[model samples]
Target chain A: MALQLTRPVLRSQPRLLAAAQFLPTLMFATVAAALVELTLLRLLSRVAIHIPDVPALRGVYSAAVQAGTVTFPVAALLAAALVTVAAMAMLPRAPILAIPALALLGAQAALLVAGESALGTAAHQWLLAVALLAVLFYSTSRRMALFVAGVGVAQAAGLAQAASANLAAEGGRALPLSVAGAGESLLLVTLLAAPVLVGPRRWSRRDVIAGGVVALIGAGMLFGNASTARTLALWTFGLGMPLPALLYAITAGAMAATLIALLRTGAIERAGALTLIVLGGFVPPNSYQAGLLLAGVMLLVLEQPRGPATTD
Target chain B: MKWSKPAVLLVGALVIAGALAGLTGVRTATSQAVTLKAVAVADKPELNPDWATWVKIPSVDVQLTNQAVTYPKGGGTVPAVSLKAVHHENTLYIRASWKDQTENVPSIDMAAFTDAVALEFPGKSAVSVPSFCMGQPGSGVNIWQWKADAQAGAGSAALAKLYPNGYADSSGFPEELTKAALYQPAFGLGNPVARTDAAVQTLVAQAFGTLSAAAAQDATGAGMWRNGEWSVVFTRPFSAADGDQAEFAAGKNTNLAVAVWDGANGDRAGQKNVSQFVTLQLSGELVKAKSEDWGALWFGAILGGVLVVLGLAALGWAGVAGTAKERA
Candidate 1:
């Protein structure tokens, strides 16, 4: 009876399957696009010796060319193509996944524009945004979406709380500024990864690896300069481990509890535990901010209980 | 398990390679040396004594008691004549000591404060002597010694003619005699008229009297006088032009030579040209001088430590990534 129920459910949820199949391909494409953009930007800088400045318009034009035209479009097209191929292969009739997928793509575009300004001239912001969007598309599901939205709300609330706490310190502004900056990046990654995490399918082995690699590379690029590396190393040594270690520990405990609970009753008690663990990690201001964000997203997606019918 | 061993070896090799690269950039030690010398000449009339016994010079002076005269070292066993002249070409040699550990002592300007020999020639008229050439004999010139004495209220009535500025009073006859005849004058004796031929006889007599009184005052001088063999050497005056001067040279000629013993202890001997009345040689070595720029090394070490931490972090990230991949 369980087998019979699973087969029909698997056939019905084609969008989730397609997203899972496309995750790795999308990540590889985004990385390729970023490399190409980086190379082109370097070449253009060498060749365009006497380019005229256009006041306020120059920054906008430069960013659009670098982030939108070069990095974003390439990453998006590659992701879209992979998703389309996977969808066709899995179940061509289900078009509902396209709605969330397209919405994920739009969020990627917005992220690219914002990131182009924030990450400075060195990074391929648009490519990173697209890669994030692909991760979200792969994970999309109602529960995962609500969890991602909740985490984003938590980060926003944290930023507001940091601002309010500024009055307690001499240079009160720094606490709020750091919170906003960190929270914004976390939000972007969460938003981009939401659709995939909340999707009806489980993550494949390849999907997880690709997701982890993309996240690591993105974090490294953002914080890998000499000054940033030194700051991170110093803080890690002086103040114990990175802030995300606590989150990992909590997440591990939750997972252990969830596993025990699942073995006995197959209930979704794990999701709540994992959520608490992720929240614990996200609370600290330390070098593990990126790790916490990625971990939180992963825990939210993986801990959700699947119905017996959807097990296939 | 087969793959694990090779992976571990590769990681070990990387760590070793990084450490080797860091060690290779370490800095090493390095050094350079410097030298100086001076000479004297005598006049025809002064040739009887070979002009070794200088009668007049503006910068420095030397007077020997009837018993203090001595033959040149390593020359002969004969006692030098106090009233007569003895000449063996006199030379003073000096070696400034610098150890390998010593740093930041540049070859340039090392001669400025090392050692110097000056010549003083007293005059009947104190006003005739230039300010650079007056001081106690054997003692170096104290360019402002007279001024210092005045400030101390130890002014002399006789020094009124010496310090026209009223900065100091006259020096007492016996004290002034010993100072003028035996040491380099604080003020330079640039003029021939300043060290009058007439004053030379009286100055020598006064120096003799002071020595006799000091001998009576202390039994040590009398004992040394009775036991020690003494001698004197006089050189001919080369010319008046050479009398009030200074020069630097190395090796053995008439220039004054200094030999530093046991790193810090030193002995000075000067040769003067009484004909022109100028300083021939002045040299010596001083110890315990300070080193330069001990700060920069510490700064570089701090910067290097920071670079090391970054390199380690890069390695750490690679390690974590490898583990994650293995688990996946």
Candidate 2:
């Protein structure tokens, strides 16, 4: 009886340990896939959008557009699956936090399977807002927690505003500015500055230099010509940001600096997650996009336990 | 127990590979959408939705949402639309259908509204597609809008014939006033709203407030309502002489967007269901215009490719250099 009991215990420990080890890697994969789906796909679409009328480049544009559109949803779906698995793996370690996150994801997946009805869309939006809150709750670092909370609030407000905007339009009256659009822009600007505000305490000399170069380049783009700013504004506008072009230019520069800081400090997963969140902002309001944004939030905030089965 | 470095890396690679393989399968399924082949028929496809040729071709169900980006945003009146297209000779006929419980026709009554649908295409000379909304500055769009009232008025142009119950007795007005065409400013100025020549209006816009009638009027359309469903057909030639109009060619890929307005839902300009741009493949052999200079476009494409490649390469090099320095 003693031998059997010990044997079972031995078996469970390794399995738990394996899951613990697997969580970070799964999160990394999730981040990578989401980045490809959101960022890379959007970039390709931008290129295609700009060159659709060029006869010589028509073939290239057509092929790229088709490939990008087809693969983006697949990448998003894959990221969702990986995130779900990662959340499940975290259950044994931090069941209290992981359960709600996992439940939210599970509910989203089930709703998606049923097709996006009006009821389903509303439910998904609320669940997404809650999921961001879960991210805020899961953060181990105080500074990161604050940032996540702010982002969560902004995202929730933005979603609510978008829904209301739809209703308000029915009155045949127009608002001076779209609150949802402004909120989304604010969220993006905050996210772009995240690395500077909430990153590692000390940065390497090389990191500082690299970040400087990125900033200079961004500044040059912003001040160089009206076209760059115009393009950025148009791109953001297409994604639903009705803000000025100058604001978008400044944010683009900040985005570059943040990425350099994160990568240099060895936050590869965070860098990828950040990219996803930023790109997710630009995509049209949809359930799958919202879920992916939440996934980015989860990956950015969820801290993996250092040891096996540490019930934090 | 400590895991070996190589073993960990191997497991990680395998997991990523498995995920990629699954995604590839999904990609394959999605790629099938790119091959939305247009049916080629010898005879001119009839404008009727129930025509034998139209039913034989495949149909795509496109989801739509409200025009939230602009004011008057209450859309989702019609959740989805079914589209079928065919090319016969030099003309392309596109049929769009959606389900509705009531048919709202245009009327002289101030409270009455007309059901309308429009197809938007990017201008031929645009460096990029304009805003999916009406359009953006710099880049323009060509719009072909068909209204239920316009269709109803196409056959019977006289106001008396359209609204028999509504009496507009010109008997009270002086004969001189009735004879003076200038008295009717809208019709005299060639306003599309006042004209009854065609059911479809060919329009151009640089942005929201810039919508106006196009110089070229090559497209025509009609709508029929039966069994609580509206089927609208848009017919246009493969090309238009005016630069403001979108040109379609055989065996070329173009982008298309759709919008629908339900009169009963108080849907009108900017308050209608809309769709994102979808790739439209016209079936045939692409005959390049040899007279135009292709060198400039080729150079621009090459330059863009080079810039992108360099940017990516720099990022990769920086990453590698950083890792090497850390090891050192």
Q: Give the top-scoring candidate (TM-score).
A: 2
Q: Against the true structure, whose lDDT is highest? A: 2
DockQ score of the complex predicted as candidate 1: 0.01
Docking class of 2: incorrect
Candidate 1 docking classification: incorrect
Candidate lDDT (C-alpha), each = 0.28, 0.59
Please provide, for model 2 over B112-151, each residue's C-alpha lDDT reduced to its tens digit, 9 standing for 90 to 100.
7789899988888665556666665556899999999887
lDDT (Cα, tens digit) per residue for candidate 2, span A1-312 = 000000011234455445545445555554555555544445555433445467768777556555555555555554555456556554443344445456656666664454322223434454555556555544555556666766777776665444322222111111223555666666766755675655655666766566566656656665674443334433433334355545555566566667777777777767766665664553225544554566667667544222221222
The parts of candidate 1 lying over 4 Å away from their true place are A1-24, A27-100, A104-227, A230-312, B1-328
Off by over 4 Å in 2: A1-17, A31-40, A52-56, A163-178, A204-244, A282-284, A304-312, B1-144, B147-198, B201-328
**DockQ per candidate, 2 decimals:** 0.01, 0.03
